[model samples]
Target: MENKFKKITSLWIITVLILFVVAIILGLLMRFNQGGNIKLDPVTFYTDMTIHGLTMIGIWFVAGMAAVNYIMERYVRTSYKANLIAYIMTVVGVLMLWGAGFIGKFHAGWTFLYPLPFKIMWEQWATPLFLYALLVLGVGWTIWTVSLMISLLKKYTLSQVFAWQHFKRDAKPEVETPPFVLISMISLVGVLSCLITAAALDFLLLTEYYSNGGFINDALLMKNLTYFFGHTLANEMLYLGLAVIYELFSEVSGRPKWKTSWYVAYAWNLTLFFVLFAFLHHMYMDFVQPETLQIIGQLASYLASIPSTGVTIFSILVAVYGTKINWNLANLMFFIGTAGWVSGGIGAVIDATISNNFLLHNTLWVPAHFHTYNALGNVLFSLGFFYWFSFQLKDGIIKDKHSMLKILLIVIGGIGFLAAFYFAGADSVARRYANYPEEMASGKFWATFGGTFATIYLLGIILFIGGILKRCFGFVFSRV
Candidate 1:
């Protein structure tokens, strides 16, 4: 039974990785055409880009989160039934939305800005279909989140689950927990906010103001909606990844066990607010937005950096200092994840600045900054968890250290491959455009390099997948 659950979880992880690699390749193809005069069909380009973005956020981020939820449940000895149901629902909904996006049914960008989709898609069916998909996604997310929170509350002490448990306990055993339990609570809040925002934004976009001046005035509303969901999701990822890294290193060579300074915990908590407010920084280019709000947004954006930067640096420095570093795959993952966050953190700080953002906002720099942190930081940290857990699930399941090395090589190689994007962005390369200006024509070289590197990175991923399949097949069917 356990083997069956593990197989499902592992398959999902591999599926997400495969999708991520595909998305990156497609994104690169789209970006490479930015400066070229070759007139590609608008329908094809728009549809592909739309699908790419949706897959990245919807499939990779949300689906990967589902995978994480399942893993956490398995680890904590929680219910698999609910998690599996949610996963199936999410997968079905993802396919529907992705299919629609690919057919150019609804390509008003993921935000689906009010009156925007209506403008582009003359088909009346498009809006309802898009909203319905979002609604389904929201329902699945709500159920999964509620189930997860209930499980965590049942398994762990209230204080650990919510920082201060006020609920009257009726039944279930209380499991002692480490310090970072607040991450789960934060994730729940983030997910809730994401769904609520999406729903509200959809309603506003769909409603007609015929009684008024017939002007669909949802301009700045989508700004806030998208910002909340976008920033909150990223923050959730960072917090969870940080927690995982802490746990991984706690037992490494006599290192301290998940105990850090109060300042560190407080810093991460406060950083969430900073990250939330920083989303407004994206609204700076919106002409309809108030000037003071933009300034406040930028300030919040900068202020948001203090907590994450302080906590992560302090955590890593302490972990690395005076301790024998375990050069194993798990520890290497910790270092690599730390590296990505640090690199992206620096890039993000630069973005918070008003003067600098003008140059970097829509360029390859934006993704470079985020990809460094998310890909290296969150995604890799999750991978480390899989590697650690996979070995513990069954005896000799992971085979040997060689399997671990292959996994790391592939993960790191992929992230390193994306670094070329940073250089291209720094060269004033704009993103999401199929053609480039004369000055930026040479930028294709950097992009091509990144693409080639990404392919090699995929090879590494193939190796990692092979190891998993070998173990799972041996344990599940081959009866080794």
Candidate 2:
């Protein structure tokens, strides 16, 4: 009989794949209509994009956390009360959000920014529906978090080393906090701040006080909280993904012996502390926010990025030094993905510079850098992890060569498309618009070229999805 824990992991992976494909399709189409000023297509645009973002977040980050929680629980033999409930809530919450957004019944983005509901841009029920979905999703996430932590506490028996020490060297490191826990802690704060931000917005909606001149103040407050959560969540994914990559790579290659493990962990922990304060970078272009706030944000933003980038590059080099590195598809992706991440980081630092932000804000440059760094960087690592785990499963089955080829094509095509977008952005193209003006003809040309590559990228996705289906239905359930 298969283990219950293994079954959960499999389910989560399937969920992640469905969400990933949805996100990719939406991403491509959104880029395709880059020049049009269409807010909602009145049918598919708002809901599809909203669901795409939220579900991708849940599947990629939230569901990944669920899997991690399950793994930790299994390691510690934790109880499973409400475990099934947690999964159910997550699925249901996503569906509700999708239905609301797609059916034209509601059209809020995943962020559901302030003054959204009071402004009456969409249906009256959108606010309530969104709040309900939040309630359901939050419960599920809280369950997973509590379950994992309590189980770990029992296993460690009040000792900080075993309880909170996510990584240790020499098999007896003397620290209580580790990078994983610190990231988790930061994520908790991010989530809470977002929730509070949502609550504040909800209050305005209920009272309709925005027409009474509360909009500006509320917007700023909400913006502050939103950016805080947004920046931290994005940064946390990179740090966590890097940690996982370092460990997995070392284990696979059998080198470096985990000597620098604590330093890497410490880097992530301290780095996030700086990330929280860097929220002001988003406000660099805002008119009302104080100049001091912007300066503080820029400083924190630059300071935070240093440790993460430093730890990742130096550690990977030391780990791989003098080793006969294998060129498996997954390993290749990891190495290239790291490079993409670093490139994005460079763009990010530049964007945070006050003068640069003035020129870059609201331009394609912003999305170009972020998509390259967070979407491509973090998601690519996650994909690598998926491939690695498939091979590592006790079933001992590996993805076929056809699957590997598809992944390679997708990576190549996607990067080409994104690079073009970056160039367009640098040339002062704006995002979220459907049609380019004559003033930006050259930029639009390159952007269209990039969009063409994206359409081709979908072909690679089809191949990858087909391979997965074949493996699960034809091979896994077939007679060995």
Candidate 3:
């Protein structure tokens, strides 16, 4: 079983890295096209956009889940079969999704916003194929999530899994809930909720398509559900990476494992609750959306971010501040990743604000913030886990020959790339255009600049993947 687990995990790492590299290339293509460096037809550019967005989101999400599941084995027995199932489904679904885009020319963008999919400029069958792909991915992920939750439950009671015992002052329980278990459970709940939302959204979409004229779905509700799934899942995946960090950061740093205190428990619980509602912010532009919900969305966005960010940052600081800690690639990534997450989060908050949203809505700023977190933040978190997991498998440290160089490239490249988006966004450059219009001429320059830096970022990721690939190949092939 252990060997099987390692092999499965090795396969996951390989698949994710391959998909990630492809997604990065697609993104760079879009940026170059926008800069007028390349001239892709409108349909082709949008097709790349759709695939690039969904693929990046899908791969990174599973990357975090795979990392979490591997580490969760330390606390509870996870189902290897479920892990494998998700792997198979992810590959199959991605194929179908790409076929829908690349082959069928379904280019409605990743959001596939309510009316857009229906306005078929592509193959008539492409829309349903895309929806079906989502269904396939959703089912597999739901099964894996439920399996992990059940595993945790088998070892700890409901309240214990949530660390309710820590809520009471000076109270100690017979079995202490590790910070990892608590955060994992919290994150898993959010993951399950969003997957269900995705399932429901897909169902409605499919229903409307088949219904033809018999039934029509409300645009507002569909849009609401779309962001509910997309925004929530995106945020939850980051939390999933954070869960891995909480578990492995200290261990990799040669420090004591983090413990769940009352504040830690409180903060995560608050996160779980508020995150569910944070998606409402996306509906702020819809005047038809209830004013009350809009207000709640603004508040929830702020509330959802504060507790987790505050507590986690404090914990990390306490762990390393002024201490002669062992600083290696893994922990260093965690440290830098936290900074990235915070930076992106601040950008998100700025845009989530009602007053600011009026100015930044649909601007490149939207991508700027999310890319900051995903590219620099959550990506680093998973990379840290990947390196650590590979290290364990080898039972010997494979020295990163140019570790400093890798970090320097990633940091410089990531910042430069994001800065272009930020600057263009602040200048009110609209996103999702294949080419910048004359009025937004500055956007062309920024896109070219961003693409150049993103190539540098891709080089850094390649180096990281090369090191992991060597170790993973050995682990999968070796007979223990």
Model 3 steric clash pairs = none
Best by TM-score: 3
Give the top-scoring candidate (lDDT). 3
The reply for model 2, stretches above 4 Å from the true place, is 35-47, 70-83, 153-217, 254-262, 392-394, 397-404, 465-480
Off by over 4 Å in 1: 1-8, 31-40, 63-79, 121-127, 154-177, 208-215, 251-256, 396-417, 469-480
**Which lDDT values do the candidates have, in the order given?**
0.64, 0.63, 0.93
For candidate 1, lDDT tens digit of each residue in 175-228? 434445555555565666666777676566656522345756665776678777
TM-score of each: 0.84, 0.83, 0.99
Q: Rank the candidates by TM-score, best first.
A: 3, 1, 2
Model 1's lDDT to the true fold?
0.64
Clashes per prediction?
6, 8, 0
TM-score of 1: 0.84
Please tell me which model should have the higher lDDT, number 1 or number 2.
1
